[model samples]
Target: MSKQRDYVLRTIEERRVKFVRLWFTDVAGALKSVALSPAEVEAAFTEGIGFDGSAIEGLTRAYESDLIAIPDPSTFKLLPWRGETEPTASMFCDIHTPNGEPSVADPRNVLKRTLESAADMGFKFFTHPEIEFYLFKSKEFGPDGPIPVDRAGYFDNVPGGTAHDFRRESVNMLEELGISVEFSHHEAGPGQNEIDLRYADALTTADNIMMFRSVVKEVAIAQGVHATFMPKPLAGQPGSGMHTHLSLFEGDTNAFFDPSAKYQMSVTARRFVAGLLKHAPEITAVTNQYVNSYKRLWGGDEAPSFVSWGHNNRSALVRVPLYKPGKGNAARIEYRAMDTAVNPYLGFSVLLAAGLKGIREEYELPPEAEENIWELSQGERRVMGFDPLPQSLEHALAVMERSELVAETLGEQVFAYLLRDSRQEVEAYRRQVTQFELKTMLDTI
Candidate 1:
């Protein structure tokens, strides 16, 4: 605390950092911040910022609304996306109850709880998230509705297009923030892009995910474009999904690697994967939380709809990339279903919890899907023991409702809140009149 306090004070004085924002997230993963001036930062480190908790989504009730945000010195980073000039620095915050306990509503804390379980097991979870999102030309509403900026095809590099320069600038900013971008390209859908981040520990990755979203949006707006992480922004095209790559490590050793095992999958890895496959339907509502998320799940080009694992098969829900011969650190499992629209903190926690449950229970993994399950006929799929994932948000909620694992993982507060919120979203969506209905029924009448 003393050293960081000195560093922050030094940075502010030397670099002319005027504001230090304590950043945190709501249950819905929207970043919230409260700025502290240079004069009060030292005291802020000792005494947290007091605010009304009731105002935050999924936070405290109105009557008992006092909450605090304690700055995490370790996450101190200057916001490069803020501007090219005298920049503002920010730190991820820890939400605290009045009595100084970690707030249960904090998504970052939720992941920390799950990480504690992993830490107890003598392992640290590392994650690399391949986050996907869409870009659209800034538009004003006409009589109809919103529209995309361009009609570019998958990976089409339009010469001198505004989106091209926007992506370039976004990548540059991400790199400056120490968030490594392994790959960035246009997605199958027009105006969509995917950027793969190098894997790191779960907490850092979650924090980076938070930063990445803001940076992308900032860059987009600077170039007169709008960026959306909405799972399915367009119809009849592939949707944006954050197919997360996860691994377990024990003191610099990859815990999930064994040369003697089938496909070189260790028992621990198989068990973890098994737990994910088993609990997948239950966590669908969390991984795909939004009402629009279901549209992407069913659109079908790349979004996985079956609970099956494969070696290099992108179609299956989970994939184990064939290990690069000597690349031990890079060997990991990829979970296909999670999207950027989902809250990373809660999403990662639930995922790790499910996988850890498998390891603890020694759950047996099913046979690997050697062939593309999508290519197989319905009867063939049945023969191969492949079952389709939950088909809708309603169906996902039904499965989640019955899942003791998910219930336990999320605990009562979040579990109840998520289920109730999701149901309302589904119902609200169901009530809305759509273009499909109008087009089909109005002409017929």
Candidate 2:
């Protein structure tokens, strides 16, 4: 710990970093930061920086508002978007109460706690996310929604395209900050793009996700465009989803892999997938979390609506990608329901909890959907026990409210606050008349 702190201090001085940003996230996964002068960072590393926690949603109330942020030196990185002459650096912080206990309401801590539980079970959780978003002309919109910057479809390489240039710059900035991006390409949506980050431990992946979103937004603003992670930004186009690939490791071995098993999926992996299928509905509110998210889930441009898994079907909620001839470690389950708009920390926490529970309880893996679930009739799906995921934020919240796994995993304060805050959002949205409604029904009414 001392060596890491010394390294951070030395780097700050060597790089002449003008400001040090202490970063953390609110319970809802919004990034929060406090900038400190170089001289103050050393003391902050020891005593921590105090702030008003009540200002952040789901953190604290007025009566007990004080919180401290302790910088994790290992996360220290120079901000690539910030000027280089007098550079800015940032480090992720762990939120603590004044007495130095970890805050249950901290999203990062929530993930860390979940990771610890996984560690106790002799496993490590890893995630690789193919994050998708749209580059828009601007933030403003008319009767029609925001215009996409390009009309390029999936995998199209438009020469000198706006999205192309934007992705290059964003990937460059991310690499500068030491985030490993495995792949980037145009997605199915007109202006939507996807960047797949290489797999990392769950907690580090969550931190990288926060940084990834920031970098994308910063690059977009620099290029005089807007980037949105809104799950369903356009009505007719395919929606953006994170489409996370998840796996569990024991020691150095991929616990999900077995040479003799079907699809090379081991018992552990089967139970894990079963757990995810069983609890996916309950975790949807945390993973999707917005009214707009439901539009993507049920929108049906290959987005998953039913709770099923398969090796070849993209319509299934969970997908097992074809195993490579020599790559057993690459064996993983891709969870397709989660969108990029999620708070990765809370989302991963609930996901790990669900999977672990399945393993512990020896959950029975169900039959694969094998066929295109979207092409199936409602009766056929029901007959196969292919239960649909919660179709709306309202329905998702109701399902989540009854989830013991979610409640216990998120802890009391965060779980309660998320439910309360989300219900209020639902009610507020219910009262509003959307542009579609106004355009379609105003004259008819």
Candidate 3:
């Protein structure tokens, strides 16, 4: 057995753990778990546990119902929320078919496949996400709307406040699970919190994001409040975003850095940014998957609407933050369009695919948009060659359907399932008579 596997088995026995939870995600980024006693874990690591793939959202058909969940020992971590005695630990699983082939419909597999392509090109992808979400008083909301845990705004110190206490517990739990957190603060919206996870390899970062969400929710429930990662849970407040910082490395050296280049960004970095800008519209459906996600994108509180890149400009789709004098490895670009509710695995996959395409094709970097693109008129933006991203989920899906890059990166199974699931969401949304329509037009019209 590998060292990680052996260590997991030894640790479980030593800790007196009673249950081990095998975790995975569906196409929509929802967490799923299957628990087994400590005895089954060893067999699970080898023969794998059988499950109904068809029951999972977009996993497979009933005819191909047989699937296996193979535990990734490296991800094994004890559930701190479950307390120390008879503790329940968890590990993320990789789904495979009975024949032992990786399932193409698996979002995790989709990302791994894309990362392999990057590996073949001599690049290693990394990501750091500033995950944002809201804390509500309860799951049940009144007509006025959900109640936030506190009214504190950006960086407001609410000592003894629920938000403050919640963050402390959440961060501690995350650290216990081996997830490194860089920063945590109250966001601009009331009761909204932002926790930034430190950079890691793209796959590990995705797994951390999955765990982060679970930890947040678990902490909230334990404290008698509710937490949500919904992109837009309020009418006028700034929507939650996951502004992801991305970089590529080549054998321990930052490939994006060059002291002599413009903005100290290397040619490879420039092309990667070019690729992201070019493909932002097409990939929007995956990064910002929900219909509500469009509200966060177009709602415009530091959210980028147009396809442009600039140094220190939050209004552009891709922002190359000002470079620190001595921090060469920190040189990276932040893609601002994605919100917090994304399927991280698929989201990272498409983003990496787009960026890699740029490097491979040598896409010419565009001139920086010094002026805030959001402040410009449509005509001015058009003149500057800045095209806007898709204004809605439906529009994004249409763009994605035509793009060979997104289709190829997602593979046929995942691509088709995502399209079907997204189309259903759009159609369901279209049929609904929203509260706005009733409040505005019912009496007047």
Candidate 4:
């Protein structure tokens, strides 16, 4: 057995861990877990537990259903929420075929492939996600619609509020699970909270995000409240978004930083942002996957209607934050359009591929959107060469269908699966009779 595997097993025993859980995500980023006794932990670490992949969403067809979850030794953690006595621990798994080849349909494998591609070109993909979510008092579904737990406005620090306590518990839970929390605070919407995770390599960060969501939900339920990462859970409030910070590194150095360049951007940084802006429209369907995600984008409040980049500009889909006076690693671009609902595995893969391609082809960064994009007139926007993002899911999918970059990044199975699934979602939305229609035109027209 590998030293790392023995270390995990030894640690579990020392901690009195009665059960060891193997965790992984399917294509849609839902957390899935299965547990084994302490007796089986060592073998599980060396080999893997077999499961039927046909049951997992977008994982396999029944004909080729065998799969295994090989635990990532580096991700082992004893669960704090499970308490100390007769303890339980968990590890994120990398799926593989029984014969031990990495499973092609695995979301984690997709990201691994992209990272390997980046490594081949002497770069590493790193990402930080600013996760946004809402804390609701109750999550009971109603015929009318969903409702928020609080009436608090943006950043309203409700002293001893349910949300306030929930944040404390959530952060505590996350820390116990070995996920670092950079900052946690009330967002611009009532019942909304944003927790920023410190940046890490793209693969680990994606795993962290999946765990982050699950941890938040678990903590909320424990506290007798409901938590949701749905982007537009409430109508008037600003929507939840998973704004991601991205940068490339070569060994220990930040590849995006240059001390003497205009805006302190390296040629590589400019092209990377240019690639993001160029492909932003086509990749929208992946980042903003759900039908409800459009409600957040179109609701304004500077939720990005166009593709452009500027230092400290919040209105653009891509923003290059002003360089810190001396911090090199902090030099990175922020992508603002992605909501919290995306499959982070696929989302990060496509983004890295697009940016790497930009570096390879020398994509030129467009003029910065210095002016408020939401306020720009059509003619003015045209003059400035700023194209608006797709206003609807249908439009977003249309663009995605024709993008060779997206297809190549996602591979054949995922590209076709996502397109097919997203279309059905769009069709379902079209068939629904919404509150707006009923209230506005039901009797008036």
**Against the unseen true structure, what C-alpha lDDT does each candidate score?**
0.86, 0.94, 0.94, 0.87
Name model 1 segments beyond 4 Å from true.
84-86, 139-145
Model 4, global lDDT: 0.87
**TM-scores of all candidate predictions against the true structure:** 0.96, 0.99, 0.99, 0.96
lDDT of 2 at 321: 95
lDDT (Cα, tens digit) per residue for candidate 3, span 1-445 = 9999999999999999999999999988899999999999999999999999999998999999989999999999999999976799999999999999999888999999999999999999999999999999998887879999888999999999999999999999999999999989999999999999999999999999999999999999899999999999998999999999999999899999999998899999999999998899999999999999999888878888889999988888899998779999999999998899999999999999999999999999999999988789999999999998999999999999999998999888788988999999999999999899999999999
| Candidate 4 lDDT by residue in tens digits, 380-420 | 98889888888888899999999999888878877887888
Shift in Å, residue 180, candidate 1: 1.7
Q: List, residue by residue over 112-169, the lDDT tens digit for candidate 1.
A: 9899999999889999988888787765543443466666767888888765777789
Report residue 78 deviation for candidate 4 (angstroms). 1.5
Q: Tell me which of candidates 2 and 4 scores higher on lDDT.
A: 2
When summed lDDT is taken over every stretch of 10 residues in candidate 1, the lowest stretch is 138-147
Encode model 2's per-residue lDDT on 1-445: one tens digit a residue.
5999999999999999999999998877789989999999999998999999999989988898999999999899999888887799999999999988999899999999999999999999999999999999999895677988999999999989999999999999999999999989999898899999999999899999999999999999999999999999999899999999999999999999999999999999999999999999999999999999999999989999999999957889999999879999998999999999999999999999999999999999999989999999999999999999999999999999999999999999999999999999899999998878988998999
Write out the backbone clash pairs for model 4.
none
What C-alpha lDDT does candidate 1 achieve relative to the native structure? Answer: 0.86
Off by over 4 Å in 2: none
Candidate 2 colliding pairs, count: 0
